[model samples]
Target: MGKVTGFMEFERLKEASEAPESRVKHYKEFVVTLTDSEAKIQGARCMDCGIPFCNNGCPVNNIIPDFNDLVYRQDWQNALETLHSTNNFPEFTGRICPAPCEAACTLGINEDPVGIKSIEHAIIDKGWANGWVVPKPAAQKTGKKVAVVGSGPAGLAAAQQLARVGHDVTVFEKNDRIGGLLRYGIPDFKMEKTHIDRRVEQMQAEGVTFKAGVFVGEKLVEGGITNLAKESISPKELMAQFDAVVLTGGSEVPRDLPVPGRQLKGVHFAMDFLPLQNRVNAGDKLKDQILATKKNVLVIGGGDTGSDCVGTSNRHGAKQVVQIELMPQPPEHENKPLVWPYWPMKMRTSSSHEEGVERDWAVTTKEFIDDGKGNVRAAKCAKVEWVKDEATGQMKMQEVAGSEFEIPADLVLFAMGFTNPAKSILDAFGVEKDNRGNAKATTDGEGCYRTNVDKVFAAGDMRRGQSLVVWAIREGRQAAREVDQYLMGATVLPR
Candidate 1:
């Protein structure tokens, strides 16, 4: 550690964001960068623990202590290198990932954890500003060709790793843009697309090719333009063309609620609503966006996805916004002794919650009520009680009688998480899926990331179901090593 007793001397300080009222008016990032001195002080807070749990706490297993020490010593170049050693894209994770590393920080047992995310953000941003982020092309080509399906974080990570290892890597994205959720699902106010753009440029400079707007597999019959564009390619060709094919496609199939009036108008998936706004922000004109402007928006689910919906709605000038969750409200504070060094259950007030939102926990939507015109207007909901099971020692939820009520809503967005990757893409590649509908791939096992089909592998949300961006990066890097080893005799890449 740069400062051995720094943990005892300094307190945690992080980058601050603009006030909710002010930031909600614009779609640009609002976080204020920390001064050099402030960042050094924050880095000094990293204790020289014999065993750094923050590394284990991080999904990508970032070298936290090393970077903290580097920053404390004012070695900016070394700090940036340390940040990039594990994570392929720190900016994305820094902005969006729920910092489990901080949750597991050694200091978090008594006080607030080290501002690891902010430090990560600072390191990478400084690297970019200093022109330290440059492409490192392989000296020799491995003569291996890899087709990484999906250009999200997982695919991006895998593509970059393979490219660095001298494999000819190409990332295929179905969307018009490269980033999957990062470009579409996420609001620009949190992270602009320029961050992704510069990285794409660096990856390109490093010899990784990106193919966007090319939907692989069987084409949809309903859409116009029946003729296959040479521009468009088939899964059959991809199978024969590449030495290895890694499926990093995200979990696209959403978890739908099949309550009565499920087909009612003005009810849509959160993904459907969020992407359109992103398109608008990206200068692409969307004709009939699922606008929440002056609409009574009702968002269902209480996860990050739901929080994102709340933030988006508030920016859209929603008439009223209400969120519902099936689970009971968590305590304001977690019992540190029980959940230290692990993600604890507690109430989390997000930036969106602070913007404006009426939230209810332990509430279940029974049915969507509609106006005579066929547009959704209200929903019948019931509050539930949570109980614990004796045999399994598991928690269960049960609805209470006489608790049903109605709330008016002009628009209802299902912000529930995804169940699995779309079956079509998986079936196209003939990959085996687990009970959860995620691709069957073990972290440590023979044929890791290897699908039933030869030369096909899977990782990230496609393999792990819905998960954090950090986990996706970890899976992507691991899958890259597995694919590299499978292609050649062995791999020199890190796990």
Candidate 2:
């Protein structure tokens, strides 16, 4: 609305990226930030639509148009304020979140959508550089202690919010670092770890205590899916010590391919491989590290996790990288009229894919060939066709006859996504689980966020299953509000 005719005058301008060849040499963020002028022009492209669907499209419901207008008018301070009002870590979302808000933009129906994510990146980066981002400690302490399990985006957001509202907050992390998945799951090439480190410093200044390397409840069910915890705390001790406990632990049970030769040594879950590389990048020494150097790497499951594997493998100088998807390929472009204002099912290519990866769709792995030394040598795969059944109108996949093939792959990483939270922790706490195995908890009304046990709550992937970082932040913020209300009989914290 800052410039009424700006949408018609300006085209979407994406942030510049480092060349693939040059970027793959090291693990660091390579996205070139937009200059102030470019960001202002991009922000000016926001139109005055009667309804701002981009707001609702964003998982955190970011005030897109307001921030855009602020940026367009050179009100950078207010823009940062508006961004931080809803999002505790816009820098993280700006770096890694797939902008669903842009897909739902009003202008995207006929033209390129506003570069909202770029503008957000500029705003937050500027905020940090200008010392505009600082800790907000409560003036009065509530004397109520809150424990947040898991220090990922959700747990961090909840801890920050509760701490700001005068409650004593302690974050428990299994890993040595504060960030759970952000510190390990995401490669530094996508987002450097310094962003999380700075936030941790700010939170600490706000009276939030971080207990890293301390595992709450029992051990993780799936070994190698996470960094092993050196210290352990029982659920009974946590419940008895803290006034309230919020389980923001993410879903960590990775889906496995139970085909022949799954026991091969070279076949590993993406989590097991990814975390090790991150540790090495963080200057930790590992006796054994999963290396893709000079090996033909096969990444199963075409998703963000798979793309990440492609990038990390390239960084490790893999001989070749091939990514496979079980489902049929989606249309490169979606029919906007049919899927406007909602996330469309269209083919998405990440920067990692651009770094050089042979991608295939509608293919399924049949077996992992062994090298006779308990190691995977190659993967046997087959092409599949999806057809709609006339009786039920449901599509099913069938392998094509004579389409079986084998590809050389000394290393295989399973990035097929997670099924649910680790079962052992939930069982140790005696928390009820939904049919999907996620922690069973309501999101509204009485007993919101309250688990079966008194003073216990669940949020993020622990309650809703595997999801985006933005969704995790939203869940954590809302759960913090509920916890506050439950303890104080009222809360000023926003939901």
Candidate 3:
């Protein structure tokens, strides 16, 4: 809208990245931001699409065109404001979100989509640099108390919103730090913890309390998942103390491969391996840090978690890294006519994959070969073909005859994604669960976000299953509104 022919004039320019060889040496953000002029040019590329599919495509429904117009007009302050209007943590989403908004961009039907995420990153970074991001404490206290369990995006978003609405909000985290997966699951190389720290400081100023190292239910049983809780509060105690409780805990139960030799020492869940590096990055001394140094690493699963393992392994100076996917490889380019205005299925090579990794698709692990001493030595795998069944019209995976193979793997990390939230917390609250094991909570109608138990709400990954951070924020904001309405008889908070 800023420039009528800007989309035709400017080609999409992605943010520069540090060379894999150099960036792998340290765990720090390597994606460089666009200069002011570059960002402005990118902003100008946004077309005045009537539908604004990017808005709907974004999980948090970001006002993309408004921010783009603001940036193009050199209104950085307004751009930041527009960005913050929808996303509570643009810095987090700007860095890690897959940018489905771009995929749904009108321009992307034939041409490259506008660099929306980069513009967002620039606006938010500029906002912080210019001290535009500050606390907006509530005007008056509401005389109500709310408890938010889990300090990830959802819990943090809900806590901030509830606190800003004049309610006393306390966010409880099982880990020693505030950020849940953001602080532990994600590698520091993608996003530094300082972003979370500053937000925590701002939230604190906004009348939200953060109680780190406080588990709200039973102790976590997962071996690698971090839990620094010195004290545990039962659901009964939390219900007795707070007016309402919001369960925003993440989906922490990782899906496991129960193949032969899964009990091997070096065959670990990705959660167990990832958090250790995060702890080490935080300067925590650990006697047993899982290392990939000089080890042949095999990362199973082809999602973001697997890509993270690839990056971390490279940083650990792994001898070799191989990433496997159960599904067949997607097309390198999407058919625009067939998948316009929606997320397209295509090959996505992450920065980690580019760094160095042997990737195999449509492959399944048959067994983790164990050394006599009990450590994983290799992985026996087989290539499979996906065939459509005529009866059910479902795709079935069939192993190719004589396609069995083995790869040297001293350290095998299973990054196949999470199945559900830790059942202990959900059971502690007596919250109903969907068939998928996520906390059962509706997203619309009168009882939205309200669990079967009175005065209890569920949001984010805990309610919707594992999803994008932007979705988590959206759920959190919506849940906050529902909680506020339930508390005060009505609410004015934006959904």
Candidate 4:
């Protein structure tokens, strides 16, 4: 807890970013940080509530009140340790997480919550500057092996936890870099890759081995499985080689639109377009890169993925940008009395939305129009409305008659989110899938985080369906505890 009367005396404050006009010119991170003193006042705003819901709100269960109190007491080092005790990668989450912890703060029920995110950012930065963050290698090796497939937050968290517990951990990634989606999907303007680089260094020093460009599933190439270098390990081989395997590979298969002209040259998946631009920004040479420069860009889907597309398009100097959503828009502000202390259903404007873009809701795509030579030129869409049944209390989406309209579109990016993890790898391992097509695993009931296969585990989007990075990190840490307990009969890793 923080100062007893601090909540009434101080107001919440957070870091500000550079102007959108300036930030759009390059891919560099533009968010400014709060000075040490400014961060202290923000931290002091935390009320000494008997029960702190912010901890539960945080997927990784970060000790929010303790850090807030430490910062208030001017003890930055203790704050950093308390922050890191639960979250393995505060730097990553501090930048990208939506900060639901703040929303759930006890003070937030009546007033603004303590600036937990900004304080977290400050503490970690201070820790790095003061050389407080260092690799803590295990005193002795456990001799057990853990093979973590994927290098995203989940895999990285699990690997770090297991490695710190003295297990031999190897992280596999298909991409050339170690941080899977973190290195590719997220734009550098949000979080600089240097944060990930240092974490990789720390993990390596802690005895965790990271092998990039190693796809961990059976795939055919020019010759055959023989031509497949050991770089590509089969699921069966992984099961045999490692004492335990954790599938942290994200739900990567994008939800597709099969309307006519979807195969047009200008139409592409958000992952395809977004990752290529990120690669180019990181000094990678590409044969032909995806560009929105001077093009009319249309982004389908109205989630964070769509927001990211808008931001990227503005950076590309798009002539015009349009973001379309299928659902009808909610109220600008939610009914707080009805949905207090919970994530409310309301419209959210992202930093990407602050950049130039036209946002529309209740819009349905009918077809993608094309030029003679297979290039997408426009899209036909219709308006929709929600109709509720009186007897059944069921709601159904209905299209407005004769409301079809055409919108210009040189490029279209599908960001409708993922339906499930890729089926091939899960199938190879004979992992059971839920009705939602995500890997089936129990949580907290019995045998939590355990896949049907023996000595195998699953977490992140692969296990729980597409979710926030915070949720993935939470699962990764929890999965590590389960794996540890299975191997050693108990574990100290926090759940």
Candidate 5:
């Protein structure tokens, strides 16, 4: 540890952010990275805990203490190396990851956990500013080819690893741009697109080929899932061309609310609404963009996606924004003794929620009211309570009597999370799926991440269902190693 007693001396400090009122006026990142001194102070707070539960707590198993010590000692280059060793995209995770590692910090048992995410943000940003982040092209080229489908964190990580190992890697993306969900699903204010663009340039320099607007499947299928793919390659053709294929597409099938007015003009899935704004931000003009401007927006779902909707709507100059969740509200604070060293269920207020939103819990939408012109007018909702069923030993939701209510909503967005990947894409590759509709693949033992289909492997949200970007990167790295092993009889790449 750089400072043995520093944890006891310093209080946790959060990164600075623009005020909610001012930040809402534009679609740009408002959260600023910690200054070098601030980050060093944060790193000093890392105690010499014997176990380092934060390591296992992080999905990618980042060497937290080493990086913290390096940063504390002002070894910026070494800290960046330590960070890049575990995470391919710290910028993404630093901005978006919920920091489960912080929850598992030893100091968090009583005091505030170290500001690890902020320190990571500072390290990566500094790395880029100093040109420390650059292409590490393979020393020699391997006479092998690999195909990575999807360009999100998982696919990008896999492609980078394989390319660095001297294999020819080509990433296929259905969208016109690289980055799957990261390109369109997320709002610009949360994370700017320039981060993804620079990485793409670095990857290209590292001997990785990116084929955007190219879909590898039988045919393109679009049913709310955004597809700007101009060309489609058959699965057989892709299999014949590449030595191995990695499926890292996101879980794009959003869970739907099939109320009476689901067919209304103004009611849309969050995916359909979010991507357009991102495209618009990228200077792509659309004839019919879904706008929350002057509309009373109602976002249904309590997760991160719903919070993003609230933020985007506020930026769109929405009249009013309301968010409702079916589940009961969690406690404002979790019992540390009961759920230490693990993620706990507690109330979370996102920057979007702080911007402006009428948030409610224990409420379920019964129906979407129809405007006279076939547009959505409002939503009929009801308060509900969760009760345990003794016979089934499971919790069941019960609506409260006479607790029905109505919320005015000219625009309604369903941000309930995704269920699974596009079934057609998996079926095209002849890959089997689990009961949850995710690609069926185990993460342990011999030939891990290999799908039932020969020469095909699955990882990230495609195999694990919807999860954090860190988990996606971890799976991608592991899957790439497995694929390399399958190709070369053995692999030196890290698992």
Candidate 6:
């Protein structure tokens, strides 16, 4: 610990952000990074706890105390090194990971947790500015070929690791861009695309080839999953050409509400609406982009995706935005004694929610009301309560007797989370799936991450179902180690 008693002396300071009214006017990153002195104080707040549960709390197990100490001592470069040693993209996680590590911090039990995410943001941004982040090409070539499907966080981490270890890695992305979700799913207001672009340049310099607009499956995916592939590759061809194949595609199958009037023209999935705006922001002219302008927008689902919808709708100059959740609202604050050192269920308000939105919970949509022109006009909803069934000993939802209502809505976005990965890719590779429709793969023991088909592996969301980007990176790095061992009979890569 750089400063043993610093935690007791310093107070937590949040990163400054653009005001809600000012930030919603455009699509760009609004949160300003902590200054050098501010970051040092934030880092100094890390208590010298005996056991660093923050490390375990983090999905990628970042060396929190070490980095905090380094930052506190003004060793910025070493802090960046420690951060990159665990997380492939601190910029991504620092911006959108929700900071589970902070929730598990010892200081959080009694006081505000250390601003670890802010320190990380400062370290990475400083690293890039000072040219500390650069290409780390391999010392020697292994002469082995690897194919990574999906260019999201997981696939990118795996490809970077394998490439650094002297293997020829080619990443296949179905979209015209490299980053699968980071490029399209996340709004630019949260993180700019330049971050992903620079990483692509660095990976290319490290000898990792990126083939965009190329689908690596027998057939192209349809429906909600975006597939801008100009070419398709068969599984047999990929197996014959590459020594190993890793499936790191995201969970793209969005959960749908199969209520009445679901066929309305103005009702769409969040994916179908979000990516268009991103593409437009990237200077891709879209002919028929979905707009929330001058419309009363209804966002169903109360997760990050729904919050994102709220932000985007506000940016589009929407007339009004109302977000609803089927589940009851959680407490504003969690009971720390009961849920310490673990993620707790509580009311979370995002920057999008702060902009402007009418938020409601425990309301279920019964149907999408249709206008005369086959467009969504409103949503009929009802309040519901969770009651325990004595016979079954399970909680079930029941609608209130006289709580039915309707809200005006010209645009309805289904922001409910994704269910599973596209079925076509897994079926093409002959990989088995678990009961949840995710690719069946273990995380420990022998031959971990290997799929049923020979030379085929699964990782990230494809294997673990829909999850955080940090988890995706962890699985990707682990899967790379497994694939390397399988090929070279040994691996120096970390798990």
Per-residue lDDT over 241-360 for candidate 2, one digit per residue giving the tens place of the 0 to 100 score: 999999999888899999999999899999989989999999999988999999999999999999999999999999999999999999999999899989999999899999999999
**Residues 325-406, model 1: lDDT tens digits:** 9888999999999998888999999989999999999999999997978889999999999889998899988899899999
For lDDT, candidate 2 versus 5, the one ahead is 5
Instruction: Mark the regions of model 4 whose C-alpha exceeds 4 Å error after superposition.
Output: 220-230
Q: For each candidate, what TM-score against the reference? A: 0.97, 0.98, 0.99, 0.96, 0.99, 0.99
Tens digit of per-residue lDDT, candidate 3, span 1-495: 879789999999999999999999999999998889999999999989889999999989999999999999999999998899888999999898899999999999989999999999999999999999999999999999999999999999999999999999999998999999999988999999999999999999999999998888855433335777777888889999999999999998899999999999999899989989998999999998899999999999999999999999999999999999999999999999999888999999999999999999999999988788988899999999999999999999999999999999999999999999988898988998999999998999998999999999999999999898889999999999999999999999998
By summed lDDT, which 10 consecutive residues of candidate 4 come out lowest?
A: 220-229
Clash count of each predicted structure? 1, 0, 0, 0, 0, 0
Local accuracy of candidate 5 as per-residue lDDT tens digits, 83-195: 99999999999999999999999999999999999999999999999999999999999889999999999999999999999999999999999999999988999899999
Q: How far is candidate 2 from the true structure (C-alpha RMSD, Å)?
A: 1.3
| Alpha carbon deviation, residue 372, candidate 1 (Å) | 1.1
Q: Among all windows of ten consecutive residues in candidate 1, which has the lowest summed lDDT? A: 221-230
Error of 1 at 350 (Å): 0.8
Residue 230 of model 4: what lDDT? 40
TM-score-superior candidate, 2 or 5: 5
Alpha carbon lDDT of each predicted model: 0.88, 0.94, 0.93, 0.88, 0.94, 0.94
| Candidate 5: Cα lDDT at 134 | 96
Give the Å shift of residue 277 in candidate 3. Answer: 0.8
